[model samples]
Target: MTSYNAQEHHLTSTTCLPKPGVLIIVVEDDTDTAHLYQTILATRYHHVAVCHSGSEAVARLVSHQGPAVVVLDYHLPDMTGIEVMATCRDLEHPVACMMVSADRLNDQEAGCGEAIRLTKPLGCQTLLQWTAKLVHKVQTAVHGEGPGDHAPENLLIGQSAAMQHLRTLIPRLAQSRSPLWLHGESGTGKELAARSVHYCSPRSSGPFVAVNCAAFPEALIESMLFGHVKGAFSGATRDHKGFFEAADQGTLFLDEVGDMPLPFQAKLLRALQTGTITPVGSTRDVRVDCRVITACHRDLAQSVREGAFREDLYYRLNVLSLALPPLRERQGDALMLADHLLESLAREERIAVCPLDEEARNWIQQHDWPGNVRELENRLRRALLLCDGKAITVNNLMLNDDERLTSAPPPSQAPSGVGIHFSPGRMTLRQIEDAAIEATLEACDGCIERAARQLGVAASTLHRRRRRQAA
Candidate 1:
């Protein structure tokens, strides 16, 4: 391998021209492609090198003296792209590489580099954009600025009392090493809460691994959690590290924990108590230290009573528990979250920002939101993609007034036997609309023309309004 001296490669002077200190090594066997890349990078960066094989790339990486970024092709003449990355890793050099390939292959195993798959005729603009991003990322890392420094703002957005309460508890939760058990209906931001805890904790520098217990097959749940050794069972070709071991010194989020098999729960309990795990078909125990965070839509307490869950394991995971209130109970948070989702979608899709109409806002508040935050997100995403105007109407959300009316208790059945008693302080505008629509429909015997006349509006206008309300 070719190696360069670092001391001799230092920048000697600073002038108006771009510094030639940043070294870029390109590994492309295709002569035309290599020349094209060299020309493209020459326009912006000053230092660039091209190698035709993985062997040559590895040699240059070991010998390089200054800061360098490597752009490697997935297919190399001497070895695979991943093999070249392994060589750079073995040398212990701080080289950031981007893997360029036309095939959908695993780039992670090849080395720690960004993976960009392009067709035979790659666009120059796309190539430059990827190169710029990779270079900037390497520069940031070299400056000792971690990835967390550039984390997106407002990861959890809301100002409702429930949200404010959660905000206050997150930092405190992060300080503790105990396993956190999160309970809430699906789509209520349980995953977001888990992420907040990880990002704010002392182990923020470490990896955050997430697994969904419900998604795993019942027969494979144990192997997935504790891992398996080579030949441990059928299809066990190689030894593997489980989530517990993978998340060492970091956070392991177990979503849908209630769905884990009862037998696996017993094994997990032992691991939690002893801080050790034994892979399948292995007698030796491996010690692991990781923060466990579990979430579930079902009530664990109920599951324990019914014998579907292990009582001992439940207690261990419940050491630090946080219950996320349903979206309907979060009051004004629905609107705030909707606005945030809409803005985010707009930015990501490069579309114009679409505001929710008053009627639509009312519909959002009135709905029960059985799917919680997830349902709201899906609705907004669909509206953004499907809406034709500047404002997202109730119709765009695909909700009906009847569904909203059915979710609320009848006004006459209020606790005081007079006015309705909607939770979270008072009834929202959506609730009011629901009530009005219900009463009007009853008065007009569901006659569209009669209802319009009774409500003092044009028939066509009322029909459109009704459709919007129903949606």
Candidate 2:
């Protein structure tokens, strides 16, 4: 395998000055694809190199002088992408890797490494975005600008009295070995609180493995968390280390733990109580020394009372608890967070920060943010993408008439009509309109005439749209 250097081969255009002090290595057996990646990266970086095989990549990375980012293809001729990244651990220097593959790999297939995974047929914009993100992360961590003494305050991102108390409680809570329960509404940054606790604790040097309990299916929860030995089940081709094993000597954050299935709760509690987990199909138990942090938006106590959750697991996790305040409860912090998020979003997107206009500011302050910080962030990001003006206004945020009419909080008392429910930014404009029309029709008991009347559209127009949707 041969390697081409950007500086020696004049791969970069003379007009563009590459960013300093970073090297990018692209590993792809396909010559055309390798050159394409090298050319694209050379636009923003000075040191760009290409290697055709995994063996060549491993050789170059092991002896690389400074910080480097590797763009690796999954199916290499000599070895796989995960095998190549596994070698980086033995390197004397720092390295960040991005694994690109046409086939989506499962958690077991991806391995426990921190390499960012990207599916094939990748867009140019996505490639640049992830590369820039990885570069920033590696640089910050290497330069000591990462988690430090002020990690809690820097990470949690609020200064309200409630926020202050939460930050103060985090360090103290981190000193213990108890399981932490973070209670809050959706988008209140429960996972952020858990991270703050992990960074402040003695296990800061170790891994912080976070898994959403609700994201796992009932059949997979046990194996996904406690691990599995090869031949344990169908598709279990090789031994796999789960979240518990991966988080050894660190923090294991279980977000939305209230959604964990009742059957699996007993297993989780046993692991927590005994500090030993038995992988599926294995007779032996492996001991773990990680702290567990659990968070839920809903009330676990209520779930227990309703028989949806276990009382024993509830008591086991609630030993040390923290209540995260919703954004609406934190006075005068919305504007501050808006400014912070706006700047952060701009920097990540590599765009100029769009200042919030007066009307937008007023709406932000007055409107009750039911979705909390997540909503604000989504709105700001959407506004940045949609805004073409000098400043971000309420209209740019799509908050004025559109959201207030269709997506606003429901009235205090229902009028025996259907309440349309959907998450913002998750649906396209066409989808949202379709949902609104369907809900209005449902509320009108399938009377298209009344639905069209309420939807402010002519009956003929509604019929035409419906016909188009069906076809």
Candidate 3:
């Protein structure tokens, strides 16, 4: 669960924020999720009321009189989110509606008239982004003024075919309410990708609670995941809601799921299957409405086959899967992300934006980013503190000699397995290209995006080449 730590910097709202008397109605079925929204939005919009059901929301909106914004959950106990919006639309007073759903809701799917639709597991930033937009729009309509120009919007930046495809798939993935498994190497953006999917889906207005399974010890995993009644354990002084309850009607991202203890995996599986969790020291089960997204760096299938992981649990958890491409496989993306991180880090440190020198850029491009985006960010963070605020040079990067040797091939000689054999007047350019494509494609498990990136060619170009060859 995220805390409202930012004192007054409500960047998600207007410059004149925490708009007093600007009533905002939040319609959610889950108490925790409703409260989470209320807590975060309350920072910017002073009067934030949370309604537990569609009927309750309708009742409140009809009786309520003032300029207001509605954050409606798509799925509710009484009626669909659209029904609540329809009710708000018919009211004597007008209210701007922001509908939140678990799935990706297109205009046709979002039949709530003109409501702003967002997907579940919404972070504070995304919520603020949309709310600020809605608030500005309402203010403009009511007072005949435009929302002032703001800084650029943050987006997942990359031109790799893999990343492009991932961007296109996020909306579709966000729309799905099924359990999703994200498997990748360490430093690949599994959680980031999951967050993107969550924010883009219909549930974007709800809280996104992430739990690192590996972070906690095995002895207390259950108590941590499921709430504990007062006096339930050694440290239990009061009743505590666990991660499941906190993420109700939102998303629960379980990172390093493979690390979860085997014995406890059964209990977790039961909760997922039944859609209910029984708190420690309590007999009654509580119903939870949360989307589960699990990620790991291990081979779960191999674990399952070896009996280290339960097959039933694996099947249940792997409803949908997304394999993240490693940074090493994505050509030029490491440097692209490095540049993006440079500006962000500089801004965060309250210093002038630093530009990467030619040497630094070359080094970044050539170095195999084994740690991926996370590693890149960490390196830039160190560089930010070390550099002289003007330009980041090669010395500031401090790359190792061994990494350079492995990443950069001998200048006169081409790397092996790229399909380029330096033979005396033997191979044609077409032959070399074909070999390189074939080798790279094989290395990437037949993924065209990964292959195209490594070869410094567009995926479409590779596709055309393949088609021409086939013909």
Candidate 4:
């Protein structure tokens, strides 16, 4: 059994009425069936009203002044379910209307609202569950929780404008079958966004296979992507299915797609355009029905312009693009994600849930999460391992700001590797500090205290500077 906490109680209490009257207008001509619904709802709600016709139900709804949920039969003698819903729209009266019908409606035509079509001989449990969810949604909406407050499964946690905009667009994008391109910085959860789209889509039950374009060798790229027949190469032993074959009738995620060689990109474009792929050293071309979702940290358009990536292939993959905002841009979400990760780690480790103190929270929030969610998770994991009591302190979280700053080579060590060169002609103060810190760390082999002494700064100040670098 799942345990319900205070938050869960708060979630459920929105629909819990204290003998509050819920006016139910059942528009069913069948007297026996209407009575059964009336009986079920009346047992819990304070009031229940019955109407035999659509016109009568509309009139009652217009006259009613309090909360109401409507249950309309599809095969009404006068109006159809869609017609009743259209009437509600015309009246400007928002009611939680559910359609009871024996016929199936097209899933795509199902509009937003509490309009659910329950077939005849409905199971009590199923009806109750749907009703409860609908009622809760209505109550939550009425109480100013906002539509976005309801957490849809697969939505990554973040309240930043970038994330909010992405969340709003996800459902719209999921309705289409076009290829989706996810562009983001490295370790920025590109795969998570791809998975979110796949799960939110209609083909959620289908498989989700991922392949890293940069991980595979150039020699095996073709065989790995389009499969290969036995004896195709010297090492070939048996026939093997490739990513496309494995992801048939599902989603195929291509990570670091910009790294894919030009030759492979041409083949990939052909396969995508024709919905057919020929195995390596094989004459047979197999048809595949799979959604292609690709991601890359590099600027693919720039790559195309530079002749490193194919322009036609870029156009093919960029049909539906979603640029994932880096963690540094997603403010407040860092703390939210950190809390969630801490709780999750506690549960997984069977340890007492530890709260991140003010100092720790400040450090986490202020830090520039270059690695994004992945880096945050790693820091939290390390903190959890080092924590002593039910609290994660700044010290417990081994966030090495100096090491983070020095990870990237200085501008002086760029392609030229002779002297520092800034694209805009001058290096900013922060960049200078980062370069200096990198040089110092390199000289001292990551000895922060020694570096601090050499730089004539306090060790604590050096540490704070490193944290600021991370930010």
Local accuracy of candidate 4 as per-residue lDDT tens digits, 90-131 = 221236777877666554333432277677775544455666
lDDT per residue (tens digit) for residues 124-211 in model 2: 5566678877777656546654446338888788778999998888999999999999999999988778878888999988777666
Candidate closer to the true structure by lDDT (higher is better), 1 or 2: 2
Candidate 4 residue runs with Cα over 4 Å from true position = 1-155, 348-351, 401-471
RMSD of 3: 15.8
- The count of backbone overlaps in candidate 1 is 9
lDDT of 3 by residue, 1-471 (tens): 444446444454555564464578888878788888888887777778887755455544533444578888988765677766654543323368888887899887686236777788777777777787777655544553222211011355678888787777777888889998998899797777777767776776676666667655476567667877878765455666777786777788888888888998899999999999998889999999999999988899999998888899999999998888887667668777887898767754567878889867766765556687878887788778778776887667764664334343344433246544556589888877777777777766666644554676656567768888889
Error of 2 at 206 (Å): 1.8
Evaluated against the true structure, the overall lDDT of model 4 is: 0.69
Off by over 4 Å in 1: 1-153, 399-471
TM-score, structure 3 vs. true: 0.57
* lDDT for 134 (candidate 2): 77
Model 3 segments more than 4 A misplaced = 1-155, 399-471
Candidate 2 error regions (>4 Å): 1-145, 399-401, 404-471
The global C-alpha lDDT for each of the candidates, from Candidate 1 onward, is 0.70, 0.76, 0.72, 0.69
Candidate 4 lDDT for residue 307: 94
Best candidate (score: TM-score)? 2
Pairs of colliding residues, candidate 1:
1-59, 2-59, 3-63, 4-63, 82-110, 187-373, 399-471, 400-470, 401-470
RMSD of each predicted structure: 12.8, 12.8, 15.8, 19.8
TM-score-based ranking: 2, 1, 3, 4
lDDT of 4 at 134: 54
Pairs clashing within candidate 2: none
